[model samples]
Target: MVAGAPYPHELLPQLVEIFSEMSVCIGYNTSLDLGFLDRIGVPTEHLTVIDVMQRFVDYLNANGGTHRRASLSTCTKYFDYKWEGTAHNSLADAKATLYCYNMMKVIK
Candidate 1:
């Protein structure tokens, strides 16, 4: 996880460089995360972001599942994924997001 305060001057350049090289960034609530990054002075205009939460909800609703609002925990539970570590931890959340994405992809 990114420790320290947001938009540390020492980290901005490196973040910009890394983001420039990335084709797409994936997150649970990507728009919110991107807004945070933008507010923190990270250049996100060139980055394409995928919101796994939205996709997961859409998938569930389109299928037989009745999920009006799907949380990370709900999605993981529905997919039968055993979550390790604490909830709300960025690393664990990322892993869970990936798992949800993979499972949804298989359905598609």
Candidate 2:
């Protein structure tokens, strides 16, 4: 499903609720992926939002490395990952974001 914007309130909560009912929702690379869910009134306690940025930072620090930028898109570009498509749909955008996030580790 595609959200109208990054901050599409209606879809976010619906997605969160669906995930909560199904299983723990997991996201990669994007720190703010679930922020919309919270901003649109999804309970933080009801869902889990993992910041892949923080996780990557921890991994980098553990291996004596550092990230130059904070944003996933920037980090992806800095690491030479390519996203060749527009982020029009939620799932596609999520996959692209994960690809970039995974590329960081792959580059390392």
Candidate 3:
């Protein structure tokens, strides 16, 4: 997350408060994430959501000609991202997802 984006690893704390003030966000499965926020009564109409997981899927299907959903571990490992912590864990997954987004941008 940047200066204005919510840091979700805070256990998704203060969701309504945080998202209500944010204009953009980077997330893994943003539909589910945003859905949760919507269910919790957080209005997300104004958010520019960047779903790393979904973007990875679009990238793969566009370049590799495959239709499938890739996991964070798969995307991270494909880019040979060195983990700063345990995989599958929340914070680690967040970092890995962002890393995937970074690599995908530069590599083709």
| Number of the top TM-score candidate | 1
Give lDDT tens digits, candidate 1, residues 1-108: 657667467687887788779888888878788887787688888877788888988887888877757789988998998877777988889888999899888988
TM-score of each: 0.82, 0.53, 0.77
Question: What C-alpha lDDT values do all the predictions have?
Answer: 0.83, 0.58, 0.79
**Model 1 stretches astray by more than 4 angstroms:** 1-10, 64-68
Off by over 4 Å in 2: 1-13, 28-35, 65-69, 87-92, 101-108
Ranking by lDDT: 1, 3, 2
Residue-by-residue lDDT tens digits, candidate 2, 30-60? 3365565556666556555555566666666
lDDT, model 3: 0.79
Tens-place lDDT digits, model 3, residues 1-108: 269765554534576677779998887878886887776577788999888888888988888658567778878877899998998677888888888888877976
The superposed Cα distance between candidate 1 and the true structure at residue 35, in angstroms, equals: 0.5
- Kindly provide the TM-score of model 1 when superposed on the true structure, using C-alpha atoms: 0.82
Residue 36, candidate 1: alpha-carbon lDDT: 73
Residue pairs in collision within model 2: none
